[model samples]
Target: MLLAMDRVTSYYGKTAILKDFSFGIEEGKCLCVLGRNGVGKTTLMRTIMGLTDRSIGDITIKGTEIGSSPTHVRAKLGIGYVPQGRGILSEFTVRENILLGTFARHDGRPDIPEVCLQMFPYLKANLDRRAGLLSGGQKQQLAIARALAVDPKILLLDEPTEGIQPNIVHEIGETLMTLNRKLGITLLLTEQHIRVARRLGDAFLMVDNGRVVASGPMAQLTDDVIHHYLTI
Candidate 1:
């Protein structure tokens, strides 16, 4: 497995958000985490990245235990995260924002990865522009580019398409598909749009009230299952 969590229960302060949750994604495949809002979908991604205040249970990446590791350690272990709100530094220029990802590089190279620029031509063209000035979709692209700069073995994306224009959402989905199918980067993403999940994912995990209520291959994500766990 590229990433696996065994019985992980994540807490923010004293309140538990994810309870006894376990799931895994294989190398070079995309696993879509599905659920309605406020169901701990984002918490699952944060837990894997070790951003929660505290967590119990095991998290392994490439068979290496990372549950006890710090957030930077997890990033150094080849986990790149594009947070839900597109956590780019608003005051930084595009170039500077992307440069931040290189801090996690094992090679210590500070240069922006060529793949990041190639993947998002807009960002390449506007490297000097302040990230805050970009449109919502453009900022999303920048966020993904920054994460790719980590040269990760696995990328964790939370709500990649939220609050974006429909056309841009489709574009982002296509880009992610290329990354997964051609470049062979493993992806774990939480998505509210079932259509996007169906288009991009090889596998699926359904979360509800912080637990894995249903999970299987994309083909096994039947309408019955969707209605039961995903419909609001």
Candidate 2:
């Protein structure tokens, strides 16, 4: 497994968010976490990135115990997170935002700086443009690019299709597909929209009330199951 979250548990203040959550992701596979609003899908990803307070669990990346590692340290160990909102530098140019991703790598994965351009070509053209000046789709592209700049083995994406136009959503889908197919990148995506998840994921994990309710290949997720566990 490229990434493994074993018996992961998390909390927000006094409220528990995740309860014994566990999952594994391999390189070149897309694992989609599906649930309705506020069901801890994002919390699970945040915990893996070490952004949230983990109640208990072990996060292993390529056999390295990274559950307790800091967010920046996890990034250096090949974990990239594209947050719910596109997290690009509003004032800085696109190039600068991407360059920041390469700063932490001790091993210096060559794919860090250049591969993002291959994934989202628009970023290459808009290198000189300020990230804030770009459209929502463009900003999202830049955000994904920045995360890729560090050449992460596992990419955790939170709602790539949210609040975007259909054309841009299609582009995001294609971009994600290309990354996993050609580059053998592992993807752990949290998506609310069924259409996006259907197209982008190879495996499916259904999380509800902070626990793994059901999971299997995307093909096995029937309409009835989705209506019960996923639909709002």
Candidate 3:
């Protein structure tokens, strides 16, 4: 498995967010986490990265136990995260923002990976532009680029297309598909859109009230499952 969460529970200052969540992702496959808003979709991503106040149970990446590791250590272990709200530094230039991901690299090199630029031409053209001046789609691209700069074996994306224009949403989806199919990068993402999930995911985990209610191959995510667990 590329990533696994075994009976994991997490808390944010005494408020329990996830309850005994268990799931796994195989290498070079995309796993889509599906749920309504506030159902701990983001929390699952945060818990895996150790951003929660406290957590219990096991989280392993590439067969190594990362349950006790800090957030930076998890990042160094090749879990690149493109968090919800597109956590880009507004004041930094596009180039500087991407360079930030290099901090987690074991090789100690600070250069932005060429793959980041090659994948996002807008970023290549606007390397010196301040990140704050970009549009929402551009910012999303920057966030992905920054994560890619880490040269991660797996990517954890939280709503990568949450509020972008429709065209850009499709574009981002295509880009992610290319990354997964061509580059063989493993992906774990939280998605509210069913079409996006079906397009990009090989497996699905349905989260409701911070727990995994149902999980299986993407084909098993029937309309009934969508109606019962995903409908708002």
Write down the RMSD of all candidates, one decimal each. 0.7, 1.7, 0.7
By summed lDDT, the worst window of 10 consecutive residues in model 2 runs over 104-113
Between candidates 2 and 3, name the one with more favorable lDDT: 3
Off by over 4 Å in 2: 108-112
Tens digits of per-residue lDDT for model 1, 1-232: 8899999999999999999999988999999999989999999999999999999999999999999999999999999999999997999999999999999997889999999999999999999999999999999999999899998999999999999999999999999999999999999999988899999999999999999999999999999999988666
Backbone clash pairs for candidate 2 read 112-149
Give TM per candidate.
0.98, 0.94, 0.98
After superposition, which runs of candidate 3 have C-alpha atoms over 4 Å from their true positions?
Answer: none
Q: How accurate is candidate 1 locally (lDDT)?
A: 0.94
**lDDT by residue for model 3 over 1-232, one digit each (tens)?**
8899999999999999999989889999999999999999999999999999999999999889999999999999899999999999999999999999999986778999889989999899999999999999999999999998888989999999999998988999999999999999999999878999999999999999999999999999999999998666
lDDT per prediction?
0.94, 0.85, 0.94
Error of model 3, residue 82, in angstroms: 0.3
Candidate 2 residue 30 C-alpha distance from true site, Å: 0.6
Q: Candidate 1 regions off by >4 Å?
A: none
lDDT for model 3: 0.94
